[model samples]
Target chain A: MENLRLLFDAPILTVQLLLDGILIGAIFALAAYGMMLVWGVLNIINVAQGELVMLGGYVAFFLFKAGINPLFGVPVAAALLFVVGWLLYRVVIFRIVDKDLFISILATFGLSILIQQLAKVAFSPDVRTPQAGFGTISMFGGAVTVTWIKIISFAAALTTGGVLVWFLRGTRMGQAIRATAQNARAARVMGIDTDRVYAWTFGVNAAICGASGALVAMTYLVDPYIGLPYTIRSFMIVIVAGLGNISAVLATAIGLGAAENISAFLFGAEYQIAFVYGLLVVILISRRIVLARQRRYLA
Target chain B: MSTATGKMALALASAALLFLYGPTGATAQTEGDTINLGAAVSLTGKYSVNGKNTKDGYDLAIKRLNEMGGVKVGGKSYKLKIVYYDDESTPARGAQLAERLINQDGVKFLLGAYSSGLTKAIAPITEKYKVPHVEGNGAARELFTEGYKYLFGVLSTSDYYLRDAVNMAAEVAKENGRDPKSMKIAMAFENDPFSLDVRAGILEAAKKHGMKVLVDDKLPPEINDMAATLTKVKAVKPDLLLVSGHEKGATLLVRQTSEMKIDVPIVATTHCDSAKIAETMGKQAEGILCASQWDRTLAYKDKWFGSADDYAKTFQKEFNYPAPYQAAESTASVLVFADAFQRAGSLDPAKVRDAIAKTDVMTFYGPIKFDETGKNTKKPMVLYQVQGGDYKVVFPSKWAETKIKYPRKLPTN
Candidate 1:
C-alpha cells in the first residue's frame, strides 16, 4: 500500500516535469523550426541564426526601455530583424548559396564572428533581461513553476510553430517552398522564382529566430556569448528530431527536457545539462552507425 | 655580391639582437615620452563584467589624473595611456595578449586579468617581460604564492572575504543563543579557483570554531541542476547553508532549494550582492544573508574614504541599476591606483610598485593599507539580509543603517 502511494506520487511529479519541459521545449522547437525551414528552402544552415535571436532579444530589451511591453516588442524585433536579414541575405548568404557546402559553412561562421564582435562592442557585455514577473505558480498536487513571460513565450512559440507547420503543409507559397526543397532545378524549370523564394526563406527564418529570441529573453538571461550555446542546442534538437520533421523536433525536445528534470532530481543540478549533451552525442553516433550500414547494404 | 651579403648579415644580426634582447629595454625613457601600461581583460567573455568595469575605472582614473595634471616622469609630465587587450577568459589568449602588450605595445607596467586563471597564465609573461604588474580583482591566494616581486594585488584574497562570512555566521549563532561550536554547517561553493579558495577559508575557520561540516558540495559554474545537492543538504539538516557561486548559479541553487521546501539560514558572498538576486528569486531570497565591503546605503561621513554615497549615486544615475561588486571593485581599484601614484611621486613603474607596497591610502570604503603581500588591511565587512525584496544591512550594529527582520519566510508582501 505504501509502495502504491509512492508510485502514485511519482506520476504527479512526472507530469509536472513534463509540463515544465513542454513549455521550455516550445522555445527550443521554435528555434529548431527556423533552422529546418531555412535548410529546407535555402540549403544554407544559417550559422548566425542564434545571434539573430540574441539581436532580437536586445532589440526587445531596448524597446521595453522605450516603454513598450516586451510581448508587444516581439513583432517590432521581427520586422527590424527581417530588414537586417534581407540585407545579409542579399549581400552575403545570397552569393554563397550556390557555393560548396564547406565554403557556405565557413562564410556563415565568419558572419557569426562579425555579428558577435559587433554585439560585444555595441551592447555592454553585462547581461540584461526584460522586467517580467516569472515567479512560481502551483498547479495540481505537484507545483509547476515558470515565469509569466515564459508562459506567454511558450504559448507564442507553440502558436508560431503550429502556424508554420500549417503554412508548410497547406499554403501555396509553402508548397512552392517544399517543391524547391525537393528539387531546386526542377522547381526553377517549372517557373518558380527560386532566388526570390530563397530570399523570403532567409527573412522568414530570421523572423522565427528573432521571435524565439524575444521569447527566450523572458525565460533565460542573455549575455553576448549566449549565441554559441543556443546554436549548439538548436543543432542538437535538429539532429535529434531527425532533420526535417517538426513533430519529431517537439518530441525530442520533450524527451530532452524530461531527461534534464530527472537528472536534476537524481544527480546534482550541474549534471542536468550534461545529460542532454551526452544524449545528443550518443544519438548522433548511433545514427551515423545506422547510416553506414544502410550505405554498405545498398552497395 | 660578397660585400652585399656581408651587409645583409650585419643587418639580420642586429634585428635578431633586438628581437631576442628587447631593444627598448636599454632606454630608460624613449623620445615618445610614453609609459605603456599593459592590461589583459575578459572584454568579451563571461568574466567581462569585472573586466570591462576595471577598464572603465582605469580609464576614468587616467582621465581624472590627466585633467588634473599628468604623472610626473623624471622632470617631464608624462600623460598616461593604457594599452589594454582582450584576454577572452582563455589562458592562451591571456598569454598572447600579455606578449603583445609587452613586446608590441612596449608596456612597462602590467595589470593582470580579471579571474585567477587568466592572472596565473599571464603572470609568466609578465615575469618574462620583467614588468611590474598590479593584479586587479583576481582574488585567488595562489597569485600571491607565485613568488613574483613584480605582481602586486589591490583586492583582498577570496579567503579573507569568505572567512568574514564564517566569522559573521559564528557571531550570529552565538547571538541567537545557539552553541556556536555545536552548529552544523553545510557549504556549497562554485568549483572555480575563487570559490575553492573561499572554501579553504571556510574550512580553516570551521576548524577554528570546531564546527561540524555536514555537507560540502563544490559545483561547476554551469550547473543547470542542483536538486540532488539540495537533497543531500536536506538530509544533513545543517544549521546554516553557505552557498557561493556567480550570480545566476547561486540564484538558481537557492530557487531550486526553495522549490524542494528546504529552508535554512543561507549566507552568500559578494557574488550574491546584486539586484539580480532579488529580481530573480523574489520571496525565495528573503532571510538570505551575505557579507560585502560596500553596500549602497554607506553614508559618506568618513572623510578619508571620500564619498561612497556620491559614487553609488553617480553609478545608479548612469547605469540605471544598483552598483554591485563589479562597480565597487572598479571604484576601489581607481582609488588605490591614485593613492599609489600620489605616494610614488613618479610614473616610474618600480617606484609606483614600491609606493603601492608601502603606502596606506584613505579611500571611500575606509583607510586602505596593503601589507607586503598586497592584501587590503582594515577591510570592514558588512552583513546584509534580503528583507521584502530589498537587501538591508543589519549586522555589526555600528553600521546597521537598517535592521533586517530575520527568518523572513514566504508569502511576505
Candidate 2:
C-alpha cells in the first residue's frame, strides 16, 4: 500500500522501472522468438533453449577474456551456435523430430541438463559479466538511468527480429521452412527437402538465442544455472504470444517485462518470480476457460 | 554337466551377496588408525564455489594435521580423512546424503556444508544419530535456537555479521551531528535463512537506534537485477542501503548502484570478498562495507597454520586464490574437531560431542568458544570497507586497521 502511494507521489520511479523493464523485455523477446521458431517449424519444444543462450553467453565471455570487445560477440556467438544447433539436430533432434511431443520435451530437457553440467565443468559455475564499457545515459534530469549496453541490446533485438521476418518472407529457404511447418509431408512432396528445412530452422532459432545471450552477458550477468529462468520466461512469452506470431511475441515480451518490474516494485522483489509464474497460471487458466466456452478443449 | 552348472550358479550368488552386504555391515567410524569425517557439500550447484572452498579448507587442515603426526587419541596416532558426497545444494539432497553418510558409510562425525540452509537440513540427522557435527559456515541464529546438543559451530551467528555495520552507521550519524534517530535505512536481502537473519539483525539495530526503514525488499535467490529495489532506494533517498544475497547479490548491487548512480551515504553488504568485488568490480566496489567472519590480516594464530596471514598464504599456494572467510572459517571448524578429538581421547560420538561443547580454543581464523546453543560466543564479526581496490578492516575499534571513509564517494564514469 505504501509503495503504491509512493509511485503516485513520485511518478519518475515508474518511468525508471518501465524503462528497465522494457529494455530487459527486449532481450527476453529475442530469446522467445528463437523458441517460437523452433516450436513452430520443428514441432519440437526445445527445453534446451536457455542452455543455448547460456553457451552463447559463455562464447561472448570467452571472447571478452580474449581481449575482444563483447559487442562484436553477438555475430560470432550467433555464427558459432548455428553450427552447434546443426550438430544437435543431426545427432539427437533428428530422431525426436518424428517422435511424440512428450518425447521431444523429455529429450530436450535431458539435453538442457547435460549442457548445464558441461558448461559448469567447462566454464566453472561463477557468475560472470563481460564489461561492455558502455556507461549509463541519464534521462529526465538523472531521474531515470539507462545503460548504453541495454539500449544496444534493445536495438539488436529489433534488428534480429527484422532480419528473421525478412528471412522468412523473402528467402527461399524461409519459404521452405514455413511450408514444412505447415504440412511436412506436403512440403516434402513438393521437393522442399523437409529434413534440411528442419535443420536450418533449428539452427536459425539457436543463432537467434545465441545473439540474445551475448546481449545478456553484456547487459547483465550469466551463469550455468541462469539458463533455466530464461527458458521458463521464453516459454511463458511464447505461450502467451502463440507460436510464430513474431509481433505479438515482441509485444508480450515487453509487456511481461514491464509488468514484472512494476509488480516487483510494488510487491517487493521476492514476489518478482511469483508474479511471473502467477501471470502464467492466470493466462493458462483464462485460455482454457475461453476454449471451454467455445465447446472445444485445448489440444 | 547339470550338477556342475548348478554348483557354478551357487558360487556366483554367494559372491554377489558378499559384495552387496559386506562393506556396509563392517564399516566403522574409525578404520584402523584413521578417523573418518563425513561431509555433504555443494559440489555442483549454486553454492559450488563456497562448497569448493569449504572442501579445500577441510582438505588442507587434514593434510596438515596428518603431517603433524595426526590426532593422538587413546595413546594412538590416527589420521583424519573425510568422505564427501555432493548434495547438489538442495536441502532434500543434503538430508538424503547425510543419512547415507551416517547409515551406509558409518561416519560418526560430520562437518558442515556451505550455506545455512544446507546445514539446517543436515543438522537434524546428525542430532538424531547422535553424531558430533562441528561446522563453520552455517551461521543462521535459528540453527542454534534449535538446541541441538551435538551441533557445535566455530563462527558467530548470522545476526552478528551485519550488527556492527548498523552500529557503525548510527555512530557515524551521531558523530556528524545528525540525529541518528532520523536516519533512514533501505534493505534488500535474499529470501533465505542466513540473509533473513542478517536482515533481522539490522532491523533490530535500526529499531534500537530509532531509525526508520524506508524500504525492505527480499531479493529472490536467482535475482540478476536490482532495478526495482534501487528505484525504491532512489525515491526514498535512504541514508543507508543494506544488501545481502550472497555473492550474486553483492556483484549485482555493486554493479547496478554505480550504473544507476545511486547516492546513498552508506552501502553495506555481505559476501563482497567471496564475490571478488574489490578485484573484479574495482572502482565501483570502493567504499562498500562488507561483513566478514575473518580476514587474513587479523593477528590470530595457532600451531597448525601459524598466523592468519600465514594460513592465507598457504591456502593461496594450494588453491591458487586468496582464502575468503568461508574457507578460513571452515579451516577453523576442522581445527575445532581436531582439538575435540585430542581432548576426548576417543572416537565415541557422545564423548566427542561433550568435548566440542566444552571447546574454547583459538585458531588462525578466530577464537572458537561455543555458548550453550552451539554458536560461537567469542568471535566478533569484522566489517571491511573496500578502499583503493582492497578490503580494509574499519570496524570494531580494537581490530580496526583503518578509519572508514564516510559518505562514500561514488565513482564518476
Query: Fraction of true contacts kept, per model?
Result: 0.12, 0.66
In CAPRI terms, where does candidate 1 land?
A: incorrect
Off by over 4 Å in 2: A280-299, B1-134, B301-306, B311-327, B330-363
Top-scoring candidate (lDDT): 2
Alpha-carbon lDDT, every model: 0.69, 0.90
Model 2's lDDT to the true fold?
0.90
Indicate the worst ten consecutive residues by lDDT in candidate 2 chain B.
B18-27
Over B1-413, each residue of candidate 1 has an lDDT whose tens digit, in order, gives 69999999999999988786663553432336555566888888778777877776566556655665656644566666677788887888999988887776666677667877887888888777667777657778887776776676666677765676667667777778877798788777777777788788889988898888877776756543454456555555677678777665556555655555555664455466653666555676777777666666665333323476666655666566666555566556655555666667676667777876775765555456666666665555666777777778775555567765544353321
**TM, every model:** 0.70, 0.83
Q: Go through the candidates in order and give each one's DockQ.
A: 0.11, 0.55
As for candidate 1, its clashing pairs are A134-A147, A269-B225, A269-B226, B305-B363, B305-B364
How well is each residue in B168-209 modelled by candidate 2, as lDDT tens digits?
Answer: 999998899999999999999998878889998898889899
State which candidate has the highest TM-score: 2
